[model samples]
Target: MTRETPAGDLTLANLTKTFGRRTAVDDLSLTIPQSSFFALLGASGCGKTTTLRMIAGLETPTSGQVLLGDRDIARLRPYRRPVNTVFQSYALFPHLDVFENVAFGLRRRGIRSVGGQVRQMLSLVQLDGYERRRPAQLSGGEQQRVALARALINHPQVLLLDEPLGALDLTLRRQMQVELKRLQAEVGITFVHVTHDQEEAMTMADTVAVMNAGRIEQLGAPADIYEFPATAFVARFLGQSNLIAGDVTGGSGDDLLVTAQGARFSVPAGRSRTDRGPVFLGVRPEKLHLATAALRVPAGHQHLDGTITDASYLGVSTQYLLRTAGGVELSVFVANSGDQQRFAIGERAVAYWNPRHAFLLGRRAETPDPTAPVAGEPVGVSA
Candidate 1:
């Protein structure tokens, strides 16, 4: 595959889409850097897929511009746009073998001599030896690669992946995540992936945009967004967060003092979303350490006195639910390092963490409480 113009940033300016009275994508705008792996991450119906469709020309934007470099292609037909989409279904022709499936794009353009290109594409996807195998004979992962090879053969400036790994099982999904990232780096083309899986977006994307209710709630590198979420929804949706409702009391040096659930804590001024009024003190479960009477709280660490309400030993770590005196519940994760102490249910304990590990968010959003247990345990609390 070859391109006359070098791949540049793919920009969407105030893009939107609607279905009758409901807005699917609401004034979405973002720039995907050249050769970057970008992910639109959100739960189903958050408009991630709709945003990708708009970029691929599968859905017309109600208002906005789709710019590849400086060229606007918002109104272009799907086939005319310099973009290709790989859907979750793979969409490979059942009767076509791997070779024909990958070469389908090139052959459609009336390229008579496609043997070399077909073989090269197959090799690029590590399917060179399986060209003769039909879609029915290949594994789920194999068919996905075939679809990728087919799309890449067109040399599109942008590749849209709509839950492309949704069909694979857990193991295969993780494997494909690595392969997709590697392929994006090797091809040097903007790859826009859409998925609801937090781990998938974090593992494969250079940047992740968390969407909610038809708009992007937050966008940044995985670690940045994970460590410092811009919104309460982003904090809970991206991963499990222990959010303690609090009121900013005052400022002390570089930390803002917060009072929550009869406990006073310090949040880094730079990390606090707001320095005054009602706020939520947020911290990752893994960042909090549990200490019993035998263990002492580290100096300068914020501590919350609570009773262990639940404890589950999950091989590599232990998940504990602690309920504070003021009825505020928190989750703590302690890594199992052989001789680590284990606390029993009903045991008095204290959860402590460094002030720098805490972040502040404006009053909670209308999303479901993340610490609420799903089934018998909190989501992502286990190994």
Candidate 2:
């Protein structure tokens, strides 16, 4: 669902979190637009949950700003903020029925005449008929819906979901992905969801923020983030990628030549400058193809000769692991469209891709230890 008008805006400025000697979040900043389904995506312990909790006022930042709309909510309590969370465990009362569970928050706030509102919330979540059932009687998906209803009943400006669908089975999880997207559209509220599942984030989020080591590595639309990852970590973490490390050697207009592993290849300049040495080349598995005899390698085209080491058939496509002459392993995914060309384990093939399909990544720097001396102070440098 698309919104005609802008919703609320959330901004984090230099947000930092520390637990004694270790830093959980490090000077992170992000802007979440109003009415957007934004996802915080990363691996476990990447500080996604810590960032979300800070935003929800459940955990205060060591130093930073959390702005919701025009208000600075750094000092606000959890219950005072116009935001609610749908916890992963649902946190529903096993003794209470679905109706009462959904109405718990309102009842605590001394909201009378909540019967109509409770029924309306239940209907919105498609759980009107199950209002009498307790959490024990509800399935995983049903309990999730109840939790969502409970959160939405408060009509908060923003809803924070911390892996709300992580506990469901595969089929039900996929189903809930679609249903949750529809529900977000219907209610037209801003949603800030945190999950480690890349596919789920890509499917449900309008904007994805890739977090790493307590910092946001990149934030953009799902397609943009996938097609043009900002860092090597984002490229390798979001999906299957073949990373080839190289050094820039030549430049031609918007293209660059890189030499690596005894081979030279041309790739787009991308966002990096020519002077950035020791760059990494990234290409998705699906973008690679097996070079056919008829599909001659055009002039300046990048190609590698390799032998198939492994193959796996996945209905729509076949995945192949090819080891090049230089002993570099490359993962190639080819579509199984009509008359599948089966390759033996030892068959020789050429894996090739276009220059524009390759991306250049900046090299990462070493992180300073928490107990280390401050910069400019006398400290021993690693040899």
Candidate 3:
């Protein structure tokens, strides 16, 4: 697991992949930094896996450069590239014991006396006691750990994971997510993980690239992309959002005025690209404030009138569906702690939120709060 060159950054320049008449990936370019955790996230058939395979040299790019630092590895064979992949199936040999599976790479490289290395890898993945057992004797999580040990033992410059957690149950998946993040921090190798789970990407990755229709729809830190989405699809796909159609008007200070169907809403001017134009203002469900009466709207906040169309109490929180006077439906989340007042389904209410929480298309983040997903929600983008 040593190299003449240091673990180098991975870069894909104008990469493209095609199958017959289908274009799987098109003119994609990305620079995955060294010793970082990066994620390619999208829905099924969004080409995230295809992009990962190209990086691993399993699928040759129709065009582009796959640079391992300054050297191009796109034309090299999978075995020749300084990259390793962990697939969802574990892909461990059924007849091989844990020790043998973990030692397979060293043995293939003509290296003898691999027992110590195998044991160390087993300990790294917390499977030291199960070395003698075969893959069939272990649970799904254990088998996956063994697979990880096998791939990590090679110590490639970059490790590619293709839906490695897709097969696990909810509890095991949650546990492994913590394990994976811990291991990545320990090794400090660049990991490019591909998954359709937004929660997974936000939870583990230092940076997330949201792919769509063979192109990157958005790329940034998890919170940056989530809080200030670049498009309507990113807003709805990552999590539930209330997108109000409006037009940008003049501004005062950092706030801009927006008029939506005769109702005026304020938005942060610094996060918007245009001073006056048609724009779709987006806010998360939890950001909106709901009140039974017309309370004084705070400074830099706008108020809208709505009626509770639906309300569901979920113990810790209450979810309400509110319809504004202009017939625009919006979702509001109210905390159930303290002396929380409950609103009936037919109760008229007003929703107020700070203008700074609003984000516009093709703009920076509106607030310091990272646009990250909720604590426990699946993330994927689709129409």
Candidate 4:
């Protein structure tokens, strides 16, 4: 049995939440399209969860409106609003079996016959045969599905998931990521997920809003956000990057030449954050390639000479830490193969990459943290 929900767009206008003097969510505004999987992603206490709670009417906003389609639902109580939330805890009634647990909402709404619907939802979450099992009898993932089915059975206009997979183990969590995406597509309703996991957001959400300090730092498709980060936070949070500081001194056709430590680097004109000022030129670790010191230079590629300060040979790839003679440090990742050139610590090498893959951002005024490794120091980061 298919449940067709007439989903409507959800909008938050100037929404803010405060706990006394501490503001959890600042003046935030975003419109989530109907039938889209949208994610509010950020680190813990960054206010992603606070934003989701406001939308679901679980947390009262200090100001502003929550709109469902054209109606203002900000003042509406949680049960009065057409929204459902699934939290990290399954929150299933311990004594109730799966069928009754999923049917609880339907019965509350005065629907007498929930047999067919429960059966369909059970199959939807792949627990058809375990319909009579209590929450204690099911695995963590199964309990998660029961919680999902219960909230989704009501066919809410919008569904809010707050770190729903946090308790599951890594293997199960990854599996649930795919399952959740599939369920969202089949149900065809707005799914607003709040998570701190960058990979999870990129994998599941059609659009990801990276929140920071009670505000959205960047919002876009996963690839767009990863490829072209709008802020320094976005660049470092989305993935590992090698950023070089430079100033836009001049230009060529559709490109600007930046001078860093007497090294002229070409950046596409569109990627230039400013017409003529300081900017951070960046590339992802995986985008950079390494060659032997004596190798011939490739045409139309940015090249730099550096000493391999460190190298890690993981099964699938080799990540290298390099420091240039000018004291700039970088990370480069290369696929591991039998014929690939290997590097030793302190060996001289060259890092070359296409200029088109470069990313640039406006410079920030803050100085580097005093506790972190100083210039030309190598640091190990997990994959």
Candidate 5:
């Protein structure tokens, strides 16, 4: 059954939350469009969860308002607000069957006839025949779907998902990502998801907000943020970036020339976040190509001479670590197309890429911790 919801954006105006002297959420303001899929992405303790809680009426803000359209719901009780939340635990009743669990909300609202709604929701989640199963009898993915169906049956103004897929295995989690997007499209209501997984955010959300230190560091389409990060923290958090600390020397037509480690490189002026003084020239690992030093680099490419310090051959691509004479390490990723040149560890090579692929970033307020794990680093995990 298709239901049309009244269109109204969810707006947070100067919202803040504090625990004792520690501020969990700073003075933050944002507008999430109606019927759009939005993601709050960050590491643990970054306040993404707290922000979601405030919107769901589970946590009260120390200041500011939570507005749905023109009405302020900041002071409303959780049951009074037209919002529903699905947590990592699913939180389904252990003694109730799938049908009863999903029908609980409608029953509580004094609706005696919930058969049709429960059946439709079960089919929507692809659990039509599992209506009698208990939560303990279902698989992790099935339990997740039941939880989602229960939330959607209420016809919420906004659906809040807090790491809802965290408990599933890799394959099940990937499958559920697709299912969640499909369900959102069919229901056509605002979906605000909070997650720490970068890939999950990139794959599921229409817009992603990267949070740091109780504030949004960057917000945009996944591709835009990944390609042109606004801050050093964003550059490193979204994915692997080969950031080269450089000084802007001058401009050449449409590009800004930068000198890093005595090597000259060109960055497109439009792609740069800063134009003067010192900056970090950033490029993704996959954008860089490695070649033997004897081979000449193409005319339009920026080149750096380095020695291959490490090489890892994954099935689909090869990752190489290169160290230059000036002691700068660069990561390069090459697709494993047949007949491509292969370099061995300790071999001298040239790392080159088109200048258009590079972006410039200003220094961050706090330098990134050296020991923190880099996003997108390959590990021995399931596909």
Candidate 6:
């Protein structure tokens, strides 16, 4: 939905929310570019919904500021703000038909000739002929469309969606994913969608903000966020990973030696702050390859000898549990091409990966403060 405002950007400066002494949202700040499909992704209690409510003027922040373009909207009433929300439940009026639901907002604004606007909105959501159908007569998907039409009819500047598709079945969920993407392209309005589903965020968002403990752990394009996760939490949360804990032994420009399980492996350098301390090496299962006798190890490939402790064959790919000689357990995935190479359990194999595939994380050691008390001494140290 579009609104006329001199302020053209959405900004949250030092935003926070608290209930009693429990801080629901910390000092979080973010800027949503105009017309961007931004997603706020996090688990429950991570302050995602609370943040959205603050932006919608449904919840007031304990501290910080909410700016829409140049206007401060933190204190504005929900109706006064140029935004609308599509709740997960659709929240359609059971008694009203699709046309009436869509026209509800327009009617509130004292617009009497709502027939044309209602028709156009319904058509935009692909619900052209269902205007006469009541909510009880429509399917789940149809009801969702009516809710969307209702929100969009108002022409809001920013549309907030809170798990709008959470009620649909798996197949319908996927279908709606495609439909929602297409609709976003057609409307070209700024969408701030909130969901705990990582796949949904990856599929729909132009940019994703990963939130944890009331703070944004990472924010970037979907591909970039998936490929180059900034923290250990992100690496583990975003996807399945084999995290090999180790210490840095040697290094030379963009490459480093990591000693783990009594073996020194050459891993990419300058990727982590823990160049000398204990570090966690992360590798996605798909990145690991099962080295065969006929298969040649590519240049810069980091090879590790392991035994296939377990194996499972899915239609698309084969999963292998490789237990390395150094006692490091790795999950490897091999694509099931036309001719799948089946590796029997307990078979010896070499699991290899490119140096660039590994993600080095965490510091090796904590730098002690000189002014701090010694292990067996009091805080007020006496010479």
Overall local distance difference test of candidate 1? 0.87
Q: Estimate each model's TM-score.
A: 0.94, 0.90, 0.90, 0.93, 0.94, 0.89
Candidate 6 matches the true fold with a TM-score of: 0.89
Model 1, TM vs. native: 0.94
Show model 4 residue runs off by greater than 4 Å.
1-5, 365-383
Off by over 4 Å in 2: 1-7, 271-276, 292-295, 298-300, 364-383
Query: How does each model score on lDDT?
Result: 0.87, 0.83, 0.83, 0.86, 0.89, 0.82
Q: lDDT by residue for model 3 over 1-383, one digit each (tens)?
A: 23324557888899999999899998999889988899999999888999999888889899999998899999999999878999999899998999999999999999999998888888999997998999999999999899999999988879899999999998899899999999888877888999998889999999999999899989999999888887777887777677767777778777777777588777777666567767777878889888876567677677778788888776788888777777777778899887878899888898888777877653333532123334564221123
lDDT of 2 at 284: 82
Q: Encode model 1's per-residue lDDT on 166-231: one tens digit a residue.
A: 999999999999999988888888899999999999999999999998998998999999999998
Clashes of 5: 0
lDDT of 2 by residue, 243-267 (tens): 7767788787877778877888777
Error of 2 at 59 (Å): 1.1
lDDT of 4 by residue, 49-137 (tens): 98888888788999999998899999899999889999999799998999999999999989999999898888888888888899999
Q: How many Å off is the CA of 91 in candidate 4?
A: 1.6
Steric clash pairs (candidate 1) = none
Cα lDDT tens digits, model 5, 1-383, are 57756549999999999999999999989999999999999999999999999999999999999999999999999999889999999999999999999999999999999999999999999999988999999999999999999999999989999999999999999999999999999889899999999999999999999999899999999999999999877887887787777789899999888888897888989999988787888888899999999999998898888899888897799988888887777888889999889999899999999988999988543654222334784421111
- Expressed as tens digits, the lDDT of each residue in 1-383 for candidate 6 is 24334246789999999999989899999999877889999889999999999999999999999998888999999999988999999999988888898999999889999998888888888998998899999889989888988998888888899988899998888888888888887887788999988888989999999999999999999988777778766765666567777788878777778887677776666455466777777678889889764577888787777778778776688888777766666778899997767888888888888878777777335632222235886322211
**In every candidate, how many clashes are there?**
0, 0, 4, 0, 0, 8
Model 4 residue 132 lDDT score: 86
RMSD of each: 2.4, 7.0, 5.0, 2.5, 3.0, 8.0
The residue ranges of model 5 lying beyond 4 angstroms of the native Cα positions read 364-383
